[model samples]
Target: MFESLGFEPDWFGLLGREVLRERRAALIAEACAWSVGLSDRPHHLRLRGRLVATGSTIGDRAATGQALSGEEDGRLELGDARPGSFQDALNAVDADGAVFADRFDREVIEPFVHETCVLAADRARRTRPGQWAELLDDLGEDGAELGDVVRAGEWEQPLRTDAEHLVLAALGTAPLLEVEAEGLPLSLVRAAEATARAAAAPRPEPEPEDLSGALFLALAAVREAGLPAPVPADDAPRLLAALAEQGLEPDEVAAVLPHLDLAPGTADRVAALLAAA
Candidate 1:
């Protein structure tokens, strides 16, 4: 799996299993129960089953509502039971519920909100159509690979491919402070090298914003592909030159190209540039 994701553990494990599954009902129910005393018995029961399957502490399982309620407060305040922390720290935060929020952080909402972001990141990384179809099948016949998910609309493709997939995966996972942390693909190394060169080139006048944006996008796409992050400063120029020497060209990078600002003639331009090179 690591090799497949370009030896990036962060990118490989970026997708969370639960977020990929149909979890709105459970999450909504958990939130409702805590905030407004709304209880979907079935939803609660399903959550309970998940808790049990995961072998979570009883107190932790019971604490979802309480922890959520304490969203305003950072501290989690358990009535009395002191269960061990959760296996997944995010999940544990949810398990801590209002109790943790009430005591430690005084109802700070960020911790709880971040849990949702993490879940989304995992869901975004999920690309298995078969498994997703099975899940939809469970929802209903209409749910299985619904027409909407099967076709490209305004977007060029029905499903994301290569670099686009990586970008969404990174965004879904959150906290993308650096390219190295994103675990992008090596396919992007060339693009990064190219962009860095473009960005650093000592032009007489400033470069166009589009050029800069394109360069950044190129670099980002490489990382999303699970390749190594480009080295910094002077080191990057050598790396870019090496990639160019290896015959890495624009066309070779189509699969990992960013969707941003892509236009009707964009594909042709990229293809032509790559082919000519």
Candidate 2:
């Protein structure tokens, strides 16, 4: 008997036959309950004419029942009355009416409904470009105007991409004129007009250099002394040559020559010529 049952006779005598049978049944029941719970849908298992395990499926597949047996050593087996894999059970659960309704609303219903409304507006704009005022009249006396809607400041980003701006511009809506100006293609006449306006604008004159008090006094003294003004055309070369011999750079000469009261055009011409050298 012991050899056939795969246990030593001495062990059976120590545990007693009834105790061993009860323990084995308990182990089988525990294993069965765990294995049944692994099913994707609710499942039941029985062992030794008694209900042992029952549970609903979780995650993707039913938990592996054979592994749940632990050290039971193949003494137990699972029986499936539902006749399907764990995946099939999950599909049935998802197909339940309440679950399907909730999922459909979240995944498919809301987005397309919003898109359809926007597309309808776009279609209305395209088909009835000149009749926007007539359409607005249907809104009754208290309804919001197109100008009010454009100035609301809340729809700027959305209107940035919307095709409706072009329609509003075509309808001669004043509020959208700036948007129309920015978005409209630049014609050759408009481009030339912009360039001419820019060119005609008055330019600010350059700021005068700040002269030292001693430099001002020296200039005043020269004027008072009635010294003859040097002829820039005759004196510029000699002055530049003397400065160059003293190792003065062209930039240094340019800086110094500006302080001297030269003829109206001579200072600029001398600076430009020497700086190039």
Q: RMSDs, each prediction?
A: 25.4, 33.0
Give the alpha-carbon lDDT of every model: 0.34, 0.37
Estimated TM-score per prediction?
0.15, 0.19
Clashes of each: 36, 5
Report the C-alpha displacement of residue 119, candidate 2, in angstroms: 17
Candidate 2 clash total? 5
**Worst 10-residue lDDT window, candidate 1:** 36-45
